[model samples]
Target: MDRNLAIEFVRATEAAAMASARLMGRGDERAAMAESILAMRSMIDSIECRAKVIIGEKGLFDGVSLEEGIEVGRGEGPELEIALNPLEGARVCSTGGYNALSLLAIAEKGSIFRPPAVYMDKIGVGPDARDVVDIRETPKENLTRLAEIKKCRVRDLTCVILNRPRHVNLIREVREAGARITLISDGDVAGAISTCMPDSGIDIIFGEGGAAEGVMAAAAIKCMGGGFQGIFRPKNKAEEKLLLARDIAPERVFDTEDLVDGDIVFAATGVTNGSFLNGVLFKPWGAVTHSIVMRSQSGTLRHIKAEHHFDRKPRY
Candidate 1:
C-alpha cells in the first residue's frame, strides 16, 4: 500500500462520522448506521485501490449486505484487504453517548484475518505491560502481573471492559482483585486502542468482543508496539464448522501476527466524544472532525483535525 493512502483512508472515516453525527440522540440506531455506511462506501468508491471488504455490515445470510469478499475502490492502486466498521457504536451514536466512531484497517492481500462473525475472548495492553498479560490467564492474575510490570499497586491499575451481562463474572473478579474498572457501553476497538496511548488512563482491556473488531484492534496494537491476543468463542455448531473448514482451531490463541501482518494502515474518526479522540463539532457553516491515522511500516501516527466549510464545497 502507498504511504499516501493513509490520509485518504482517514477521509472515509471522517465522512462517515460527519454524516452520522447529525443523528446523535435521535434514538434510531439503524438509521444512523445506514447513513454512515452510505457515506463510508461513497468515499471508498473514489479511492484508487482494489479493496475487498473482509469484514463488513452483515453476514452471508443477509439479503442485502456488505459481506466478505465484496470488492471496493476504483481499481487503480494496490490490492488490499479491508476490515471496517463504519459505525463502531451505533447505540452510542443514537443515544449521544461516548466512544462512538468510524474505523477501518487495511493491509496487503492475504495479510488480514478473515474470521467469521463470532465472539472472541480478547486481552490487550500497552507496550509497558504487553509481555505480562495473557488471555489464557485469569483476570485477577493478569492484572496482578500487569501491575508488577508497571511497578504500580494492583489498585492503581485501571481495566477497561464492555458493560454487558456476560461480563458480570469478569467485572466481579477485577473488582475483587482490587483494580479500578472503566466500563464502557460499546466500541471496544477504542477501548483496546486506548491502552496504547500514554495519557489515555487505560492500563489494560479485557473481555469478549466481535472477532472482526479483534483483528482491527490487533492491527492498531501491532503498530503501537503493544500486545494483543484473541481466542475464538464460537456460539454454535455452524460457527464451529466454519472455523473447522478454514482450519482455524477454536482453542488456538491468535496474536497480532496471526490477525494482521505486513505493512498495515489504520484510520478512525470520532463520532462522539471519548477518551482518545473528540466527536465532530458542527458549526454554523460546516463541521469539524478529529481523526487518527497510523501505519505499521514506518510506525507513524498522525492526529488530524480538519474543518469543512459547506459553502466552499459541495456535500457528498
Candidate 2:
C-alpha cells in the first residue's frame, strides 16, 4: 500500500471521533456508536482501495453490522482487508470516561485474520519483553519472566487488564506477584497497544476481551514489533461447537503473524483522553484531533495533531 494512504486512514478515525465527541457524557452509548459508525463509513468509502470488513461490530448470525464483509472504499486501489472498531469504548465515551477511540487496521487482501465474535484469552507485551511472556503461562509466571527481560523487579512492571468479574483472580495473582496494575473499564485495544509505547507506562496486558479487538491490537503490535498471543475462549457449548465446525482449535495459540501478516497499517483517533493519545477538543472554529498512524512495511510511526476548520471543511 502507498504510504500516503496512512493519512487518509487517519481522516476516517478523526471524522468518527469528531462526530462522536459531541455526545460525550450524554449517557447514550448506542447513539454515540451509531454516529461514529456512520461517520467512519462515509470517510472510509471515499478512500482509494477495495476493502472488506474482516473484523467488525456484528456477527453473521446477528444479521446486522457496519455489515461485515461488505466492501468499502472507492473500488480503484489495491485490494485490502479491514478490521475496525469505529468507537472502541462506546460506554467510556458516553460516560465521559477515558481511553475512548476510533480505530482501524488494514492490510493487503487475505492478510488480516477474521476471528469469530467470541471471547479470546489474550496476552500482550512490548518489543523488549516480546520473547519472554507467554499466554500459556500463569499471570505470575509471565510477569516474573517479563520483569527478568526488562532487567527490573516485578514491582516496577505495570500490567493492564479489564476490570471485570472474570479478572478477579487474575488481578489477585498480579497483586500477589507484586506487579502494579491498571484496571480499565473498556478499550482493551488501547490497553494492549500501550505496552509497546515507552511513555504509556504499561508493561503488559492480560485478560479475555473481544476477539475482534484482539485482531486489531495484534496489527498494532506487529507494527511495533511487539508480541501478542490469543487462544479461542468459547463461551458456551454452542460457541465451542461453532469453533470446532470451523476447524478452530480452542487451545491453539495465535501469534502476531497468525492474526495479521504482510504489510499492515493501523490508525487511531482518540475520542477521550487517556494514557496513549489525547481526546478531541472541539472549538468554535473547528476541532483538534490527536491521532497515531503506523505502517509495518516501513516501520514508520506518525503522531498527527490536526485542526479542522468546520467552515472551510464542511465535510467534517
* Superposed Cα deviation of residue 167, candidate 2 (Å): 0.9
Query: How would you encode candidate 2's per-residue C-alpha lDDT over 148-242 as one tens digit per residue?
Result: 89999999999999999999999999999999999999999999989999999999999999988899999999999899999988888888888
True lDDT of residue 225, candidate 1: 85
TM-score of each model, in listed order: 0.96, 0.96
TM-score, model 2 to reference: 0.96
| Number of backbone-clashing residue pairs for each candidate, in the order shown | 0, 0
Error of 2 at 200 (Å): 1.2
Candidate 1, 1-316: lDDT as tens digits: 7999999989999999998898999999988888788888888988999999988876322233456779989988899999999899999999999999999999999999888648999999998887888888999899889989899999999999999999999999999999999999889999999999999999999999889889999999988889999999999999999888988876899999999989999999999998999999999989999999999888899999999897997563
**38 in model 1: Cα distance from truth in Å?**
0.9
Distance from true position, residue 110, model 1, in Å?
Answer: 0.7
Q: What's model 2's lDDT at 38?
A: 81
Off by over 4 Å in 1: 59-65
Enumerate residue pairs that collide in model 1.
none
Which regions of candidate 2 are displaced past 4 Å? 59-65
